[model samples]
Target chain A: MLRIILYSQWKWSRGWLLPVAVVGFAIPYFMLRVGYSGERYWDAAGLLEQVAAWGRGYPALAAAIGLLVGTSAWIHDHRGDHVYALVLPTPRWYYVLLRYTAGLVLLAPAMITVFLGALTATWFTTLPAGIYAYPIQLAARFMLATLLAYSLFFAIASGTQRAAGAVLTIVGIVVVTQLLAGIAGSDLNVLEAAFDRITIWPGPLEVFVGRWMLVDL
Target chain B: MPTMKLMLAIAFLLALPWRAMSGQAQDLAHVIDSLRERVSFWDSAAGYYDSITRADVDTVRVGGFAVITNGADLAAVEDAVNELRDRFIPIVGPDTILFQDKYFAVLGRGSHVVTEDIILAGLITDNITSQLHDAAQWYFGSETGRQFQSWLGPRVPITDSIAELPGIYEVIVLSPLTVVQRCHSGDIDACGASLALGLHQTPEEALRAWFNAADRRFLVGQLRPQWDYDLGRRADQTDGERRCIESESDADCVRILAGLYRSGMDVEAYAPGTNFHPSLPLDFATHSSLAAVALELGGDGAYSRLITSNALEPEARLEHAARASIDSVLRTWHAWVLRAAPPSVEVQPRSAWVTLFWVVVTAFLAAGSSRWR
Candidate 1:
């Protein structure tokens, strides 16, 4: 059953996986090129500025890949009304676990490709003294971020379209509330407040708010 | 070989002043250029701006004035400074640099690079000060670190540590995080004042001060709740260490105190001068303790604001909101803090081989004497 689930996930994502993995592989190389000017005397500050600017791509890439893979995991099942999985002889929880782990296993290629690319980029680059590259840390962070995004989108995919629509309506109301509050010149900033709630320490999204430095002090 | 040595001696002789001047400091212009180009303001904790405050600006101002005064081109520098002071100060907003570009247009004079640097130095400090002020207002209004500004909205200033300086750059290469750790452990003048009070402080005294300040900041910052058991433990440890000081060897006392200090036990047996803090200087063994008095009155930030005031005013408590106000405070702070501006421009680089030669010759004679004996 595990083999069957794994094969199914692979078949679903095979086309998207290779292309996105290549993009992930290219990110660190591009970041390195952008950061390190071909000068013997490079300004660490200036180089860091470029590197940091490029760092925005890491999470976005993770989210994009996570969304693609996660949605793909369930898209075929959703189209068939999940009847294919319902007929499986395994217990419900076991079948769900099989699907989930299978999806995670499929993401390994992309994660590994990104880590190796980042490592290769770090190997070739010369950072100023006192600054260092965190290839492994970055790779680990990327993995977690991708996992988080995948879990989130995958959970949303589990729900019916009406449930998704209700979530969308709640988000829209919040945005409208924030806009109206701003128009009224109230100190209320619910959007920023919500962002802070989600992105502060102990919050799941907190990890991404920190300086996304590939090479850092 | 004789002529070679003679020529070598001549070259080294001329290199002395050049070496000395190189060690003096990089020109203020380079620092300004770096500030304009690179620094993004990252305040470590709320209510505290970066460490480089009015004092650094004074050093740069005095240094810049010296360069201008001593240069053969004083008239040009003086004209630029005067133009900025009189005409530009009024219109100096966040967009003062833009105003500067416009000023150049009206006067039809080429841009004064030196004057522009001095102005940038002022702007950088102002930028830091305002961010601090905003942070303080936010924190004071709502005692939480949650309310952060959307943008850094300011240029960066040198923070808890100085920029990597030449000669001493190696000593100060620790990142801001490392400095903050040292500060949390009570090593760096966490309050941004220098530890250069010309008094010999032992490791024990330094550690003692660390424990005390950590305890103070923790208390004032309201880091731990009033009912925290750790506070009691820290106080007891301080007492035990103080009692142990009398019975044990000073070395042993330091060992005991060090443990207690690390454990964060505040010393009940502590007296005013029991162990002097690293940066806080008292009027005496018994009178006017700066750190204690300030905390008793307010919090660590207030006390810090008193001495360093990364955001607070020294004399006037001036609001550095607009460019005009920022420029005003910049002018006022310099006048009040420093002595008359010195003519301390970089000295002409001369050779240093003569000193090197003499030292070598002396070493040679000393070695020969060992054989002669």
Candidate 2:
């Protein structure tokens, strides 16, 4: 049953995942090529700055890949209104697990490519003294960040149309509140406050913040 | 006679056009000079306009200090000023006169006002409380008025909500200095040395006192821009500077560092935007955190004692104020700094477990979707 679900997920997402994987591989490699090119390799501070700029792409890529895979995991079921899923012999929770597991397994190709790219970039070059590479750590962070994003969007997408509508309605209310606050000359920014809560450390998006350097001191 | 007459006629004809061309050239030069003067006038006018606009800044006075800000940012500026007063008064005592009538600008968040003090901008703007907290440190230093250097870092409370200390924690953990390492490893005397509370010397002597030979040599490389600029300005490079960079000589490094001071070279001006202070060992936050520990130990009037102590050395002043041994004060400070250490880059086990828990919970939530039912 898991194998069948995995095959279906692969067929559905392979087109998108293939390009994502390629990009994932290219980002770290290109970062090293551009960041540490020629004389830059000797300039430690400048190299670190360049590496930091390149590092921004990882969390964004992770979030994007998560959304794409998560949405695809349930697009077929949502379109069919779950008629196909309802006929499976396994329990509903068990069937959902199969689908979730398959989607997670499918993320491996992207993760592996990023890891390999980082390894090739770091290990092949002699990093300046005091600066070190963290390929495993970067890959792990990317994986966790992806998982978090996937779970969030997956939970939302797997719900009924009414559930999706309710989520949209809540978002609309927040936007309206912000507009009212602005008109009323209130300094209270509900959206900014909410964003800070969600993005700061200990928040769900904590993994996306802070230094994401593949090579750092 | 006819040949002579013809030659004289040719000479007169050539001289006539030469006079006309010289006159035209003079007119063109006069026009260019006039245009240059107009450009200079406009340049000065632009500068005058900028100064006038800066002078027109709105001032909001609260708690013995004036907050200078552009009119647009007045509301936020007032909040920050009030925050500073509420937080600062307790540590420095209400009796101290703070910058009486002096203007201070709250610069970040697009607020531009001119003042003599350091501009609080960049990362500090992320949290207004911390921003004002830093401003209060500067103001308090001014209030204390050069009679005493407040080796006591930022005396204001680091806002409890922020996850990391704005800029200081990384230096504590990652600094290559032996004194900082020793302080981290529970050496009280080293903590005193690292904090520079004991040494009240010239900047060069303070640098020598704080960091050892290797660290000084290492710093020469780190502060390359300043060293390079200082050397570049001279007709010839100093032998010590050449030896310091090329041969990695510590003696040469020391000589060059001292020579910079003797030459009255303004290295900070040369290396713009670099916090390349030779005298200060640790950051202000680290110093303030230690002071906070002392004040906490000394109870009420600790700040008064700290401000009024006759002791020349800061460590003794701290002891006099805290009413405790310098060793005890330092030990407490070290512990506090370690406790306030920023979050590690490595993913913690607890975070990993929490992430897993969320994954499962969200998976269960998806499973319970109404469409399946």
Candidate 3:
């Protein structure tokens, strides 16, 4: 039963995993080339500036990996109305575990792409004194970011469209409330308040906020 | 005969628009003579004048034909050019005066030869210093001022609410120069000193003391013709009145069409209909003092010293402080975005090769399974 479940998940995920792996492998190398396009003397400040500018790509790569992996984890189950999954499973938690593990297993290739890309990008560039490359560290961060996104999206994907609508409505309501508060001059900075609440330490999104330097002190 | 003919032509030229001709010609001739006398001075200053002309000849042309002609003949035309040169002198002469003032302000007085060299050296040094100061002040003083104020007053409080609250003592010492230090130190004494000095001072005195530096800096940076939304609005009103008159005229359609065409292309045709020029309702010094106080309260180390030592008025100090705080916050926010990291997960030694092999195998299996499904 577990083998069958794993095989089904593998089938659904492979379509997305292939293209994502290819793109994922290329992103770091491309970023490295673009960053070092100018003169031979690599000033530390200049290199850091380039790296900082290109940092946005990391989240994007993570998000793409997450969305693809998350969506693939559920598509087949959704298509078959989850009836086979419900009938064959010894327990609901057991079935979910099987699906989760399989999805993670399938994500391995993309994670490897991230690792290889970071390694290649770091290898080609000669960093200034006091700076060191952490290709493994970067790859680890990428994987964690991908997993967080994948898990969140997977949970959402498991639910009905109505659930997504409810979530969106809540977000909209919060935004409108904050904007109106600003207009009213109430001194209640709701948007900022909410952002701080979500992005600060101990927050669910906290991990994404700190320095993600591939090379750092 | 040749000399007589030249004299006759000069007399004729002198007779027509004598006032205009004499003033212009004499000024130009004087400038030419000065240029000849101080060839080195002309060589050094010529590049600066040329740059200004290149930057603003078209805009200057609108003031009058003479302005443009004078600027173009800055290096060439005689007499009339001297008067033209005088105008440029007033603008650049301020730099010399400012240098003198800064030297006097800093060194008090020195020996005659030393003072003279100091004045010259000061001019060059002060020129760069004044430009940087002006750029910073203008950036804080313009529309960005409001944004900075908002960010400082509201956004910062919300974002970093957990940070230590500003003390009353710190609020009092808000001077232009020390604001940076006070903010950095997080000490309240500096803020107290500013508040004590600035809060009740007369507007003019305050302006003289605290706001003058920033004001001078701002004035230096402002481009000519002076952009004022109110003036733009008045121009717009006049354009509207003209359009109405045209509508009533015989060439209404043609005039309206022409006006529309001009409006579409020419920015001057459609002026701004608002009073957007930055005006300090509070005396300059008071504003400076306020900025100084605010900077101390906000803990902005980089700018506090400049703000407090500059002796800005309370209001200017406060305004500048608020602006600096906002700028600092925005910069910090930008930095945060740049520094954000991805997630982390450990991998096996052969993760790359193994993952690739598995991916290929998985693809084949998935393809076979897809057919079964």
Candidate 4:
């Protein structure tokens, strides 16, 4: 059952997933090419800045992949009003479990490609003293961050149309309240407060914060 | 042979410019013409200088600050001065005695001219307060007539945050000195050694007090370029310096450093681009953080206490001001420093576990979807 679900998910997301994985595989190489220029002596500070600039793309790529794969996991069922899922002998919870596991399985290609990409990139480049490439650490972080975003959007996408609408309505109300507060010259900012709560430490989004360096001291 | 070729190349480059000078003679004439042009330009600009001297300098006073400017934006300058006074009030106390008759002149944006007594900052800038704060440290320090340099460098106030503390943490962690690493690991004695508190030694004794033989050798290597420059300037390489660099003799390294100190190189070798005094181990931020912790523990009248206790040794003075044992104060500081360690590249275990918990929770939420009905 899990294998069938995995094959179905691959069929659905393969086109978009292939391109994203390819980009992920190419990114670390691109970072090395752009960061170092075969100078006899490397300025660690300047190299650090370049690596940091390239590192920002990982989280953004992870988010994109998560969004694509997570949505694709439920898109067919959602389009068919979940009739196929309803007709299956498996319980709805079991089906959801299968779909979630399937999505996670599909995430491996992108994760592995980036890991290999980082390894290849650092393999060719001679890093400065006290600096080392974190291919495995970077790959693990990418996988976890991808899973986080995937789970969040997956949960939302798995809901009924009305449930999704309720989520949107809540978001709309928050925006309206924030706008009203600003217009009335109040210091209240609901969006900013919500963002801080979501992005700060211990927040689910905190993983995306701070330097995601591939090569660091 | 390479050195000979390098010198020949330099000589050739220098001669290239003047090789045609005597033959053409037109080059010399052009140089004279350019110099004359520059003189005339300066002669014409003298009128502008005369106008500036003749123009009235406007004075803007706010709280304890008095700024003299060319009447461009007195209102903005007034606000900036008021803000600076607000910042300084916390660090220096409410007593306006130190601020009395201190005049600052603003000439243009981001420019500060410092005389013996007066700090003239030119124009309004985003960093006006920071620039003024830096200059005022010296002015205030001089007014207090206390030597606070034994432990802290300039005693600058530090505002700690995630973005700020990690840099200082990196310094302590990545330092070559074992004492600094131990300090980071919460060793109070190591913290004292690293901070060099209560050590009344000359700069050489101070360096020896903080660093061991291997540590001194490492420092010598790091400061090799500066030592080479100083040696080359005198055109004399001492036996100690020669042995230190060539034979990697640690004792020779220490001796050369002592000579450098006796010959006028002090804290300048350790911390360049800072107006620091001798015998301090850590950088400005790290010292400031410790001082800040002391001040916070001391609470009300802490700044006054700190200033008055300057006659005592650094650790005694800090303890006196904070009204706490040196051990407690240093332990607290060491804990704070540890907490500020740089964020890791790998995902933290807590973060990973928390993320997993959330994933499971969200997955369960997805399973309970009303669409399943």
Predict model 1's lDDT versus the native. 0.45
Arranged by DockQ with the best first, the candidates are 4, 2, 3, 1
Per-residue C-alpha lDDT of model 4 across residues B193-264, encoded as one tens digit per residue: 887765546766767778776666655554523333653531345566667766888778777667654565
- At residue B364, candidate 2 shows an lDDT of 89
Every model's TM-score = 0.43, 0.67, 0.41, 0.67
Give all candidates' CA lDDT scores: 0.45, 0.69, 0.45, 0.72
Error of 1 at A184 (Å): 2.2
What is the TM-score of chain A, computed separately for every candidate?
A: 0.93, 0.92, 0.86, 0.92
Top model by lDDT, which number?
4
In model 2, where do residues sit more than 4 Å from their true spots?
Answer: A1-8, A26-56, A76-98, A118-134, A181-217, B1-82, B97-166, B197-209, B223-237, B245-250, B262-272, B278-311, B320-325, B364-373
**What's the TM for model 4?**
0.67
As a whole number from 0 to 100, the lDDT of residue B370 in candidate 1 is: 17
Q: How many steric overlaps are in each model, in order?
A: 18, 1, 73, 4
Q: Fnat per model, in the order given?
A: 0.01, 0.40, 0.01, 0.56
lDDT per residue, candidate 1, A1-217, as tens digits?
Answer: 7898899889888998998899888888998887776332124545666777888888888888878876787788778876786677655455555666787898899899989988999998877655678887777767766776666666566556765787799889889999999999998998988888766644556545555567764
Model 1's chain B yields a TM-score of 0.18
Per-chain TM-score, chain A, candidate 3:
0.86
* TM-score, cand. 1 vs. native: 0.43
Q: Extract clashing residue pairs from model 2.
A: B153-B288
